[model samples]
Target chain A: MSAPLFNLRGVAAIFSAEMARTRRTLLQSVVTPVLTTALYFVVFGSAIGSHMREVGGVAYGAFIVPGLIMLSLLTQSIANASIGIYFPKFTGTVYEILTAPLSAIEIVVGYVGAAAAKSIAIGLIILATAAFFTPLQIDYPAMMALFLVLTAVAFSLFGFIIGIWAKTFEQLNFVPALVITPLTFLGGAFYSIDMLPPFWRTVSLFNPVVYLVSGFRWSFHGAGDVSLTASLGFMTLVIALCLGLLVWIFRTGYRLKP
Target chain B: MPIISIAGVAKSYGSFTALHDIDLDIERGEIFALLGPNGAGKTTLISIVCGAVSMTRGAVRVDGADILRDYRATRRKIGLVPQEIALDIFSTVWNTVSFSRSLFGKPKDNAHIERLLRDLALWEKRDNKIIELSGGMKRRVMIAKALAHEPDILFLDEPTAGVDVELRRDMWGLVRRLRENGVTIILTTHYIEEAEEMADRVGFMKGGRLVLVEEKTALMRKLGKRRLVLTLAEPLAALPAELDGWHVELESGGSQISYAMSDGAEKGAAQIIQRLGEAGVHIKDMAMTESSLEQIFVDLVGAAAGSQP
Candidate 1:
């Protein structure tokens, strides 16, 4: 019998199961991030802005909107995707997926697709909440949406790698907690890297998150700390690297099969 | 033709071999039981065929489809009920079963899923989360999930381990029905009687090797032993010279004599009794028993272990 080139139904099954899990944990998945965004707006946007006043010709409160959104986007994307794959491995339910008639591409699409979708939803929610604190502007609405989607998909795939690599619960929470969060904070989510000394600015260029936040901010205000080309190049490079690593993982069955 | 065929299959973890070179074929619609002690590679073999574990060397074909080259086709044709109760605790029984059906590339078929739940006696608990169900119910849900996609072959790895007797009977009935519906069933179990009761053919694995495979009845006939035991009315210190030609052992402090009936020994029982009368030993009572599958399994495994270097 001729088999279909793709198992779309299997992909949809995994996607829907993951999405249903989000719905079941709505309070933790959605409400927690939204509330955390509200708190950040209250302290950093309103309270701190009263003293700093402005940054790079925009109100201090409005300047951090894109940064705030990017922070939540990066963290949530990783958390969602990591937990999505890791939970199954932890519970031993992943045998079903591994044994199913699904290709590696289909499995990735199902899991990473759901994770990206969820993070994007939370990003949009945070954007809506941020609007309550500062008037927003989108110089290139299409570009803003593109950057949002690319970042979510790229980081979600990265999170998928971490999920597979993690052997214990502590390891599962390690990268997002100790690595990604620190990088996002240092990537100029709160202020422009240009405002730093030339030495610090040079060191900041090594941080990949800087490009993501810069491109995202540039889409909102038509200006950023880095050139638009560099930002887009960095985002594409991250995506390519993540996809490459995933291909290797599935091919070797690293940490997934023994 | 065999629904599943294995050739030169082997698996190793570093220096340790989990499964030795194994070759076997399972016929269509037959209940084939794999009998072995712990660490005998039963689960490893199943995992290799089901694509859960990578094999060091070998090839397997399911329904004429090469397991590696045409894995999607092969996997779609088989359903596996793993030994562990692996499930999402938050997922309801309905969602779990339906999702499994869809995962195998089948389109939404609520009718089939509903019928499966009812047959497994899980319809009333369809809406309950997996964590809320009893262990027996969880096992039933696993069965429901495996059968959701209507596979042509089902691998039940230790299907009734730790299960109550009532549910074990229920599961046996269900398995028979599945076979009747033309689904080939393969199971690995420690319960020897399970194999004796349900398996048309039985394969014994020992120390990662396939040691024996035969029809259940034929295995019994070939290796089964019978024993005759007599209780003495008067204690005897030793057997007389007339019984020297027979294999008999004195036991119970000289109050009982046990005889092992070997090939062509059916007539020996009468001759031994006549000799006992002639030797002036009064017979009290006697009983005969046949070796059960459990005894045969132990002896086979024990003998295999003894021969290992």
Candidate 2:
């Protein structure tokens, strides 16, 4: 009698629209990031690889590849989802979405799902570009794919919340620029936390990006600063927290409905 | 049962109330025009019924389904043309309309979309992106998008505000045609003539409360006050003491005097004339005008405003 409650059409509509928007701004969303990752590989992989020896038992160029991919993945996942949701709010088109026959879950999945998918695709592209500078290997390919998806989905959900919380475009960029990017850089996207002093290594654990990058790095080389179990468990915990927050936002209509 | 039943629905944001005890039952296939000024809870009421804004108290049922429990059913049953231009500016008009239909879980029907675009005169601009369209064209795309889903009820909140005369007439014609097709159209408008021209029933809202709702003809017949304008032979310096009992005012450099008579036919006008004669007031010519919905609305709102300190 409920008539299959969930609406695939509604979800597909939103998903396709978001994906279409990503394609429309391919240069800014996909091409530019892939290019940026290529530049990073050139500076850190080829230029610096000449002088640097092997660290963590892997070549310097290859060691940083997973972390670099994680860096782009995290930032893009948040960026795509946050901007995806924020643009609707900015243009006032969010009213149409709010009024449509879509459940909050369906809407979230549509937007966040498309954003995660886009990030994963771009992340893979960056990894592919990195292969040109250095050799790459994945000891646990399935786990790598799994962690890639997990990180993308989790960060995209976080970005979705930012989209809802942000009142202005400047506010939308605040967390990504002033918070996430800085945290990712300090989180050991380019270097190992093991290289830091003992106190700094302990402090690095506090940055949430450390777990994400380390977890993702473990998937590639079977090694990380934090234990593999801890990284995986931490990501799952963060995903749960993000999901809980989203459910609350949708239920309370915080900054979404008046 | 009424198609849409707003039973004791009220909304308040923090300390300020937006809608207060608004209970309305809109019938099927009728053009219901809610007339109000800015911030009169017209948009609030519309938003609540659409489930875009949650009500702080009471409930709304669309087609007998509770809005809270059965939002999907209710949402699928109605199309809303918001007061603002709310469309994906990057998408083509055709894609926007088609996407709206899909959002309802309705199957793709190109024929239906083509027909809606044609009816709204958006057929030629079908492939054009919404950002490229002119203001009026964008409004037409909004209408086309709303109609794409084939909803049982259509809520148009200030659909023609700032629209050109030609588009307004076109919208009116489209509304009439939709009513003919048995779509329940509830529209909020500040334009009294639009209500007078289109609505079968008219409702007046003031200060977050619905003052009255009645059939347009019945309302005009019942509360339609008359104004008798008298062109005086000479401009009066001041109103005489005899003119104090009647609801009269001097205007146009005091050369014309207007009085609010009790009925549309001005039955009490004779008594007013007699009082004027007692004051030795000379009249050059006289004319009478019946109050339109605009005046009734103004009076209702004015009375409410007058009651507030």
Candidate 3:
């Protein structure tokens, strides 16, 4: 029999393995993000919001919801994808993947697909938790979903690259912890770039996370520090760059093959 | 057609050459054992064929499909059980095997998987996590995972390394059964006896080059030596002139005589005995022994080493 053009079963196998890992580590995968979101609501929405009142004509408590979800989405996307691939490399089980009748694209689709799904789930869960704290509105639900998915997929791809690039566990976590988290914080996850001084605001424009948060926030409150088109454009650019890098990685075999 | 054909394949890492121009072809449904010492490029060669390592030069084909160009087609036909027990500790025995089958783009065959697990003696522990299984069970799980996709050829890299004697025997039995079912087998091993006991043909590698490849029995017959050892009735001070024509040695302070014969020299043993009898030498006990594969292996490697500058 001729082989199928696509190894859909291979992709599904990787996807389910990653998802099962999530289910197995429910506390780390789901609960921690939800609890962290709750803590943010308790601290920022209750204590801090009671004093700040509103930001950009939206309640301060409601304003940070999109940013918070973006934060979790970005981090979880990176974490899921990076850990998913890195663990196999670490355990030497990647031989099975490398030897299987799988193209690099199929491998990426399986890993990134699961990672994006996970972060999306966490993003929605955080959104629901945000709802319990303050009333929320999704002005463009479809656009919101678009931004959520695109951001998750883009970052998950980036994480897959990190997973391949990393030689050690510390290196595996370095990009997400040292780089992505700080970028998320400074990218107006809690405060708007409009609130930043002029000079710093221009520098904030250089931070890619700003575009993601702004686009997601606009989907929720119909307002953002940047234009919606710019946000979407930046999202597309990030996705394209990540995909390009992934292609090169697989083509070159990078750290994945010896 | 041969199930696997490797031609002019070489792999190098910067300044270090791991494998040097190697050409080999493995026949269908036969057990081909690759015997070599460490750093002899056995694993590197296997890795190149299995697509785990890129070859710096040349091509490999599985059933006429080029390995690099038709990777999916070639890879689908081969299963590799690497030396290391690489597995997801968190995954259960069943999921591990099933996942492997799916990874090869095979449709879910629960029945096939069940039978496989049963065959490997892992059925009862199918639900148990890999970490929960013993080392031997984990090794069997690796075998199960490799076979899950039902590949036409299997490459076992040191399959019995670190395994207990009984488990090794079980694995040997399993491999024989696999061959009986028409799965071509290529195994690289440090254990010469494993090759001697199971291989139909054997290839000897030394320092990244395949030095010798021959049918196991033929190799033994060609390089094998025979020794006729006799316990002399009395301790002799020296060999008699009549026995000097034969390659004989006096051991145990001249209390025993050992007659050595190379291939096609078995006729010499009877002459040596007659010579000893004519010389009034009496034998209290006599025994004959043939050289083992291990001895032939050491001799080949030693010769190769000696031939090196």
* B1-309 per-residue lDDT for model 3 (tens digits): 888899999988999988889999999899999999999999999999998998899899999999988998999999999999999999999999999999999999999999999998999999999999999999999999999999999999999999999999999999999999999999999999999999999999999999999999999988898788999999999999998666789999999999877766667878888888999999899998899999999999999988866
Q: What lDDT would each prediction earn against the true structure?
A: 0.94, 0.90, 0.93
Per-residue CA lDDT of candidate 3, range A88-134, in tens?
Answer: 99999999999998999999999999999999999999999899999
Which model, 1 or 3, shows the larger DockQ? 3
Please name the candidate that would achieve the greatest TM-score relative to the true structure.
3
Stretches > 4 Å off in candidate 2? A1-3, B227-288
Residue by residue across B32-147, what tens digits does model 2's lDDT show?
A: 99998899999999999987898899989998999988898899888999989988888999999999989888889999999999888889988999989999999998888888
**Deviation in Å, model 2, residue A108 alpha carbon:** 0.6
Residue pairs clashing, model 1 = none
Q: How well does candidate 2 reproduce the true complex, by DockQ? A: 0.59
Candidate 1 lDDT over residue span B1-309, tens digit each? 799999999998989999999999999999999999999999999999999998899999998889999999999988999999999999999999999999999988999999999999999999999999999999999999999989999999999999999999999999999999999999999999999999999999999999999999889888998889999999889997879978999999999999998777879998998999999998899999888888989999999999889
First chain TM-score for all predictions: 0.98, 0.97, 0.98
